[model samples]
Target chain A: MKKLYGVPGGEVLELDYPAVADYLVQFLRRELAWRGFEKGLVAVSGGVDSATTLALAARALGPENVRALALPHAESSPESLADARLAAEAFGVPFEVIDITEMVEGYARLRPDMTPHRKGNVKARARMIVLFDLSVAYHALPLGTGNKTERLFGYFTWHGDDAPPINPLGDLYKTQVWGLAGELGVPEKIVQKPPTADLIPGQTDEEDLGLSYARADVILEHYLKGYPDRYVEGLGFSPAEIRRVKELVNKTHYKRHLPTVAVLSSTAINEFYLRPLDFRIELE
Target chain B: MVRHAIVQLAPEKGQIRRNLARLEAALAELAEDRPQVVVLPEAFPTGYFLQGGVRELALTAGELEEALTALYRRVWEGPLDLVIGFYEKDEREGAYYNAAAYFELGGRGLVHLHRKVFLPTYGVFDEERYLSRGGTVAAFDTRFGRAAILICEDFWHSITSTIAALDGAEVIYVPSASPARGFFGPRPANVERWRELAKSVAAEHGLYVVLASLVGSEAGKGMSGGSLVASPEGRLLAEAPVFEEAALVLDLDLDRLPPVRYDNPMLADLKSGLPLLLNDLKRVVEAL
Candidate 1:
């Protein structure tokens, strides 16, 4: 048999902007509305992912129906806080600010010796608490903003940044998000800014991952397409880059799934029962 | 000239009554000056992707007729034929099938029933786990012409469509609920792929093709809806917009059929060559 499948090299990361924009907009509007919530909310972290997500939601269900919430800790960059506001203002959505410093500090002081890594996790979860709490108060659907790159690398806090029911940018890689971020009317300064989680001071996502997104995204794409390591290396990527993406993806497999359930019966939720993810039964 | 319509719909998941009511409303909105044939997307009465829920939702032909007659009588007191995909229960076989049924409202209530032959069990699909594979591959007589139905995955395989063509099916209606996956192309890659498939199937067999697809999202998976109709020569008559609910109504000229088949003659040639094929198949079976 001839060679049937291989890496589609030309413009692999390129997207059909118009078609993609319509699909994303419709995705948010239709998914949220069917569940009886016309409103949507996104936790803007001053990153391209959240900004793109916010813009999509605004386009889907008018900006008035979408809320932009920025939860900032004391250690978070002031620039991040300002940029989050810029994103919210650019889209004309109401921006709500909450200082998570007091909440995270409550737990941090108990374990004063907790490393910056643990502190970062606490800050992320604290923001999630505010997000879900407001979801009920505002009657808005919580939309996840984590990009595919961050998700595959397991860079996000488990159930913290990835907890929302609907996500427009979850399928897009970080590199691809930049392309869409521009078309969605996001500010140039915000789109060009170095990506970060903004949980800790002086932190850059590239620095933390030990690889830039440009290098990581290509490696991840080729790797996921079942390209051999040798073939990926021929594409001008270093072995370390390929290994870094592969290891992180394998290590964080559990983060991509729901909690493991021990199947004791034939009918277990998400195990043997196997209901469609969106399956709903209208009750009397 | 037959007024054929593909009503692109986004059904509420697992809501049989609501979906049927929605379909009824869509049909009522169409022009009633002429008799029309309408095709609804796969699983039109109930939403697709009902994993274990298929067993509970599957209805016998009698039960489906009972529900639709009550609901659809409000739309067309005149002649209005319908084609729709649904989950079917076979009481005699005690099996559940992903089936598509054709109805001639003015005449026979149920003309043909085609269960999906291919149950895609790979990647995002779990059809084999829930649906029994359909055994028959033949066409039936309709008020319009000899017609056949191919559910979503059934259309992907060429042999299934070939069998219908060989059985003298002059018109093929495909009701699908395919999800949008790829973004590298100018449209959803599936949209482009379906366009090519529609063209190829219509041109090869010299048959009129109508595709009705579902729109809307379920748990963030958007059912890509680009419902379309192609002429016997593979010319696109009409296409609905993607990711939104829209109706694609067009006039189909069955008179053009004689000229189209005369030009291609692929189906006639196929009929002439079928005996040789059966002989070869029998030899292979004997060797096995």
Candidate 2:
């Protein structure tokens, strides 16, 4: 029998920008409206991922319905703030600046020996608090901007950037986010900027993660697609890099889920008490 | 061995004449390949976004037969078969159906008309409100080989594909007009999801699964055109570009079908387990 299969390892995975943009816009609009809200709030950090999310939201629920919040701290990059403003103006969405330095400092007063990581966590949680509070005040849902790479590496603070009700960019890898940013007409400077959590001054994402997002995305894509470690290594990835990626992904598993409750009965809340939407209760 | 041509089109909404013209032009272009079988996207004649105007856009059974016969005479030669999707008006029942018809060149008329069994009424789809459901699934002998036709949502249900395969379908043609959705990574998420479905069906059934999806946008919702041809061994033979109009011609080797089915006897296992499944189903229903 003749082999009809094409050559192996030649498949190229790419996005159709126009189609993807249209789909996401429609999806966001439908989901938000279905949940009984017409407005959305997106925290813009002036990075490609958040900018893309903000643009998509604005396009979905008109710019008048989308609000941008720039929560910057004393240690935050000034360039990030400027870029956030630039993005807001470019997309014609209303934005507000909330300095989080005082909030972070007030929390620091409680513990004088706070490490940089812990301080970053405080800033992240403080921003989320502000965003959520404004979500209620503005009658809008808070949109998450964390990309797939950040979520996989546990780069986001739990209950901080990850606590938003809706996430449009959560599935996009860091590199793919840049592609979408270009398609969404985000400012070129922001799209090309080095990705940073902006938790602290002078800290870059690549330096903190110890690898470039391009390499990390490739490794994570292969790993997430169920490729064996040996096969990924054969595709020009170092074993050490693969091990690091796997460890980060494994360690972050807890952050992706809610706290587990003990199950003592058949009708445990988490297991048996499924989501309301899952129930097939029909109206007569 | 048979060469199949899968045409991915972006039909104008509610414009049957223009859409047919476009399809005729595509068939004329594809004639150079001399494909034994040609498949087009679902609802290519009247487009997929027909809600209130479906009855107006639908074709009576005889009208559809006449249109197809005319099209076949214009573009096809000896033994060239075409599988195309349209909205068929059931004159006797006074209802409409999402249907696919198989036309063999130099034959009497439409060899088979498979109505879509699953009419999705969920988000973005109000098919049930506009069209009645199909009731049968069977495979028939074609010029290429034993083949079956399935409309978009019909192939999503695994049981439909299983029944087709059990009825001795060596090749399953799925014509879809699914909109593009979700971009999780480099690839469109909807396309990835479809790939998983196609691969599972082809691998388990040990037959070729050919999908031809429509492209273009309607009312701001876009259809990602990533038509695919998967082998019995669950390998992708050819994949067309997404969100673009393209015709893919792939030469399929039918000789590999027997060896693949021998290696993986999934069908045999399913056939053996049917009695037990039926018994359990009866018991469960009775208890309920």
- Tens digits of per-residue lDDT, candidate 1, A84-155, equal 999999999999999998999888899969999889998888888999999999999999999899999999
Q: Can you write out model 1's per-residue Cα lDDT over B1-288, one digit (the tens) per residue?
A: 888888899888888888888988887787564537888898877788888988878889778877777777876787678899999999998899999998877678988899998888888788999889998888998877788899988889888889988887888999999899888766788988898899899988898889999987877778999999888898888988888899887888888888989998988888888777998878987999
Q: Quick one: RMSD of model 1?
A: 3.1
Model 1 chain B, poorest ten-residue lDDT window? B27-36
**Structural similarity to truth (TM-score) of each candidate:** 0.95, 0.57
How many clashes would you count in candidate 2?
A: 0
For model 2 the local lDDT of residue B36 reads 82
> What 10-residue stretch in candidate 2 chain B is worst by lDDT?
B180-189
Best model per TM-score = 1
Give the Cα error of residue A248 in candidate 1, in Å: 0.3
